[model samples]
Target: MPESLNRELLEVSAQVRGLLQDLQNLGFDEVPLAPPTAGLPRCGTAGRADGGEPGVSCRPESLEEIRADLENSPCCDLCRERGNLVFGVGDPHARLVLIGEAPGREEDETGEPFVGEAGRLLDRILSAMGLSREEVYLCNVLKCRPPGNRDPRPEEVAACRPFLERQLAAIAPEVIVTLGKCAAQALLQETTAVGELRGHWHEYRSIPVMPTYHPAYLLRNPASKREVWEDMKGVMKRLRGGGSR
Candidate 1:
C-alpha cells in the first residue's frame, strides 16, 4: 500500500476505535460502524480524561475538600457578602448540568442562577428537551453579577473557578451544557468563537461539555433558535439513549 493511504487508514482506524470506546463508556451495547460526519461531534469522554488543565489546576479529592476550599477561599467578595451564595440548584445526581456566564440583574436580586427572564426562557427550553428545573443542575461561571451585565473579566473568572470546580465535584454530572460564549470559554479555557464551538461536544475538567446559545442571546437573535433547538435535540437523544461515541 502507498504510504499516504496507509496513514489515512491508520487515522480512520483510530477514530473508529475511539468511537467504540466512547460508546462503551456511555453504557451502549453497540455504536454505528461509521462516524456521524455531520451536524454534531460524537459524544465521548473529554480529551483530557485526567480532569486537570494544562496550566490551570483542580484539587477535588473529597466533598470535604471541596467544602473547605469554598469556605477558606477569598475568591469573590460578591459571593461572600451577597444575600445568598446561589452556588447551584438541582438534583445532585442530575445527568445534565447547565452553566451560564454569570448572574444577571434579576438573578442578582434573587441570588439564584437562571431566575431572570433568560432563566424563564431557559426553563422552557429545558422542558422542550424533556428536562425540568428539578432534573438538571443550574449554575454559572461566576456566582455573582458583573457590573451593568457586562462580560465577566478574566480575573473574576479565576476568582470563581474554585467554587465552580467544587460544585462540579459535588454534583458529578454526566454532561455539562455551557449557555454562552463566556461560560463556554471559561469552562474550556479557550477564546474560540461560539459559532465555531457550538454543535460539538468539548470537554472540561473531564466532563462532556456542550456549547449552546444562551437564552438571553436567543431572546435577541430568534433566528438562531433553530440551531439551538438542533443542539437541544442532540442532548435529548443522548439523555434518552444513554449516549453514542
Candidate 2:
C-alpha cells in the first residue's frame, strides 16, 4: 500500500476511536446504526426526525429566550441557596460586554450586577470612559453568589459556563471586558495571573477580550485604578475603531 494511504487510514482509525470514546463518556455503551431512509427529513430541518409532519425551524434562541431559560433553570445547586439568579442586565445589542466573577451579597439581594460599593467604582470608571451601565451589557461567570463570597469552585464554574456562553452568543458583543482574575481566567481559559493578563488583548472565540482588575480589587488597592484605567482606554480605542496598544 502507498504510504499516503496508510497514513490516511491511521487518521481515520484515530477519529473513529475518538468518537467511540466520546460516546462512552456520554454513557452510551453502543450506538445502533440505522439504515438510511430515502425520504427522511434532515435533523434540525422543518420536519419530524422520522419524516413526519413539518415542524418549526430549529434556529438559535433570541436573547430573551436565553434569559428565560436561565431564569427557569433549576439545574444548579447554587440556585437553591441564592436569593436571586442575577441574570445579566443592559442593552441586549450593546457592542461591549463586561464580565465579572460572580454575584456579591448586594447583587444577589438586588438581582443586579455591579450594584454594590465595587459597583459604584465601576460606575465611576464607566463615567470616566463616557459610558453608562445601560449602554453596555454586564454579566458574571456565575449567576449565583458563592458562600461567604468566596471564589467560585471549578464545579460551579463548569456548571454555570453554558449559561454565560449562550448569553454571549445571543448578544454577540464586539468587545468583552473580563473583570478580576476568576472572570478573566474563565473567559480566556488560561491560568495566567490577572496582573500579567491585564493591559493585553486576548481572544475568546474570536472576540477581543480585555482583562482588567476587578472593581473590588481596586477598592482594596486604590493605586491599581490607574492600571485599570489604562486597560479601559484600550477598550475605548477598540470601540472607536482605533488600533490597540
Candidate 3:
C-alpha cells in the first residue's frame, strides 16, 4: 500500500469523525446511512444495516429555499424591529464563507450583512487577500439585527441557529471565517474571547473555522487589524491547500 493512499484514508477518516461530532453537537444523534445494493460494490459509509427505519437520501438545499423559509417564518422578535431578514448574500457555491455576529443599523436598513462601515473594511480585507465579496459567501449568526446594534441574546441565537446550520450545509465551504466573538462563540460553542480564538484552526461540522475580530472591533481598535490579517493569511493558506493555523 502506498503511503500517499494511507494518508488520504486517514484524512477522510478524520473528516468523517469531525462530521459525526458536529452532527451530535447539533442534536442529531442518529444519522441514517444509505442503503446498500444487493450485489454492487460500495465505498465509505455508504450502507446501513438491513432493518429499522428506511434510509432517506438527503440532498444539499439551496440558499433560496432557506431564505424563503426565513422570510416567511418569524424566528424571533428581532423581526418586529427589523426592516428585513437579511438572509445572506454572495456566491452560493463559494469555497469560503464569512460569518458575522449580526446585522447593525446600516445592515438593517440595507437588507444585507456587512454593508456598512464594517462591511467596507471587510471588503478591504478581502481585497488584501486578493479576493472579492463575490468570491466568497457572507452571512451572520443572527439574520435579523437586534435593536440599537446590541449583541444577540441567547434565545435569539438559538432561534436562528437552524437557519445558520442549513446555510452552512448548503454552502459546505472548505473554510469558514467567523468575524467577532458572537459569531465565534455561536459556532464553536466556546466561551473564550475572540482574542484567544483567533490565530488557531477550529472545526465546525468538518469545515475549518477561523474566528477573528469583527470589523466593527477593528474600527474601534485599529491595532487589532494586524491580528485579523494574520488570521486571514492562515485562511488563504488553507484555501491554497497549504494548511496553516
Candidate 4:
C-alpha cells in the first residue's frame, strides 16, 4: 500500500479502537446509531489487523449465549489477530439472513459485517424491498480478510465453516440470502453459476437459501444489478408468504 493509504488506514483503525473502547466504558446511551453515509462503506472504520484490544473469552451454554460468546470470545485466529471479529449483525430473530462470501477491508476493520461499498448498495437494495440492516442478519463465509483481497482458498473456507454453521443454527432464520457464487456454492455445496443457482430456492439443512449476485460484483458489472433485483424480489416474495419468484 502507498504511504498515504497506509497512514489513512492506520488513522481509521485508531478511531475504531477508540470508539469501541468508549462503547465499552460508557454505554449505549452515550452513542446512537446514525444514518449511513451515501456511497460510503456502511461498516464504520477499520482497525489493526493484529487485534487492537484484548477481548474476553467464555463459553456460552445456549444459542443466545453462543451469540454473545462469539461476540466476546477472541479464540478464533481472526479475532485474536484482528482487533475485531467480523460477526454477523441484525435482529437475532430476523426472518432473513444475508450471507456473503467473506469480510472485506471495511468489515475486517470495524468488526462488522456488510459495511463496505457493496454493503452500502446492499442496504439500498434491501430498503427498496422494505427492509433494513436491522431487519435481517448479515454475515460471511469467512470472518477474516484473505491476503490481497483474493478469493478465499478452500482451506480457509473449510476452517470457517463450523463458525458459520453455528451462526446459522443459532439464528434459525426463515430465509437466507446468499450473495455471490462463492457463498451460494459453499452453503449449497454445489458448483453452478450464480445465474443458475438463483431464481429459485434451495434447502440448507431445511432452511431456505436464495443465491444472488454479490454487491461487489454488481459494482464492477452494473448490468448484473438487474439480475440481483430479480433475485431479491424472490426473497421478498417469500418473506411476504408468497411463493419464491
Candidate 5:
C-alpha cells in the first residue's frame, strides 16, 4: 500500500479507538445481546460471502438500546471524516421502512437520513402514499457518507451491516421499500439491478420488501416516476391486507 493510504488507515483506526473509549467511559460496555430465537425472521448473514447463515447476534428491545449499542461499535474509515452518525429517523414502531444507499453531504451535516433534494422528492412520494415522515422509518444501508459523496467501499458496508439488521429487528416493520439499487442489493444480497428488482415482492429476514427507483434517479430521469409509483402501489396494497403476490 502507498504511504499516504497507510497513514489514512492509521488515522481512522485512531479515531475509532477514541470513540470506543468514549462510549465505554459513558457506560456502553458489556451490553448483552440476545441470541436468535424462533418465530421471528431468520436474521442470517445476508451480506456475508463466506456461505455462512448465522443469525444476528442480538435483538435489542427498542430503538434506543439499538442506537446505544452502535455508539461503541465503530469499525469503518468513514468514521474519520464523518461529522455525525446518521443513525435514522421516524417512528420507533413503524410498520414501514424506507431505506436508501447512504448519507450525502447534507445528510452528513444534518445527521439525518434523506434530507436533501432527494428527500424532498421522497416527502412528496410519502404524501402521495397517504403517509408522513413520522409514520415510517427512514434510514440507509451505510450510516456515514463516503468521502466526496463517492460510492461506499465493501469494508464500510460490512462494518455497518449489523447495525442495519439490529434496526430491522428492533422496529420489525411490516414492509420495507429500498429506494435505490444499492440499498436493495445490500439487503437482498443480490447482484440484480434496480430496474429488474423493482415492481416485485421480495423478502428480507421474513419481512416484505418492495424495490423501487431511487428519488435521485427520478431527479435525472423524470420519466421513471411513473414506474416508481406503480411499485409503491404494490407496497400500499400489501400494507392494506391485500396480501403478497
Candidate 6:
C-alpha cells in the first residue's frame, strides 16, 4: 500500500476507536456498524428523525402541562395546610432561572415565589443585572411553604423533587442562580455552606449553576450584598457568552 494511504487508514481507525470508547463510557454495550438511515432528518432540517411530521417538536411535556398535572398534588403535609401551591412564575422560556429555598408567608398568600421582603431585594439585584422578574424564571426547591417559614423537611423535599426536576427540564434554562444554602444544596446535592459555594460555578443536570446568598440573608447582613453582586456579575457574564470569571 502507498505510505499516504496507510497513514490515512491509521487516522480513520484511531477516530473510530475514540468514538467506540465514548459510546462505551456512555453505557452503550453495542453499536450498529450501519445504523438505519431511513427517516433520519438531515442536520438543520425541519423533518423529525423519528418520522414524525415536520415542525412537530418531540421535546418533553411543557412546564404548563406539568403544572397542570401537579395542580392538585397532595404529596406532602405542607400541601394540605398551604394556602397555595406556589408552583412558580415568570417566562417559561427564560434563559435564566432563579431558585430559592422555599416560599415565605407573602409568597404562600400570593401564590408567587419571591414576592416578600427578600423578593424586593431580589428585585434590586435583578435591576443591577439589567433584568426584571418577568425576564427570568423563579421557583423554590420546595413548592409549598413550610409551616412558620422553617426549613423544608427531608421528606417534603423528597416528595416535591419530581416537580422541581420536571420544571428544570421543561424550562431548560441556560443558567441557574441558587439564592441560598437550601437551594444550592438541593440542586448540587452537597452540604457545603453558601459562603464556600458562592462565587463559584456548579452544575445541575449539565446546566451551569451559580450559588449566592439568599436575599433574606442579605437583608440581615447588608454587607454581604457586595458578594452577592459579584456572583450576579459572573452570572451576567456567563449569560453574555463570556465564560465564568
Q: After superposition, how far is residue 185 of candidate 1 from its true place, in Å?
A: 0.6
Clashing pairs in 1: none
Kindly list the per-residue Cα lDDT of model 5 for residues 67-119, writing each as its tens digit: 77666666687876798889999998999999999999999999999899999
Error of 5 at 10 (Å): 68
Q: Candidate 5 — worst ten consecutive residues by lDDT sum?
A: 41-50
**Which 10 consecutive residues of model 4 have the lowest summed lDDT?**
41-50
TM-score of 4: 0.70
Q: State each model's CA lDDT, in order.
A: 0.77, 0.87, 0.87, 0.77, 0.86, 0.86
Q: Could you give candidate 6's per-residue lDDT for residues 96-165 as a string of tens digits?
A: 9999998899999999999988999899889989999999999998888898999998888888877887
Model 4 residue 154 CA deviation in Å:
0.9
Which lDDT value does model 1 have at 173?
A: 81
Better of 3 and 5 by lDDT: 3
Please give, for residues 1-245, the per-residue lDDT of candidate 3 as tens digits: 89999999999999999999999999998999876544532111222222212354334456887888788888889977798778888999999999999998888888999999889999999999999999999999999989888889999999998789878877778999999999999999899998998999999887999999999999999999999999999999999999766
TM-score: model 1 vs. ground truth: 0.69
Candidate 6 lDDT: 0.86
**How far off is residue 126 in model 3, in Å?**
0.1
Better of 4 and 5 by TM-score: 5
Worst 10 residues of 1 by lDDT: 40-49
Top-TM-score candidate index? 3
Better of 1 and 5 by lDDT: 5
RMSD in Å for model 2:
17.6
Better of 4 and 5 by lDDT: 5
Cα-based RMSD of the predictions, in order? 16.1, 17.6, 15.1, 17.0, 16.6, 14.3
Q: Assess every candidate by TM-score.
A: 0.69, 0.76, 0.78, 0.70, 0.76, 0.76
Whole-model lDDT, model 5: 0.86
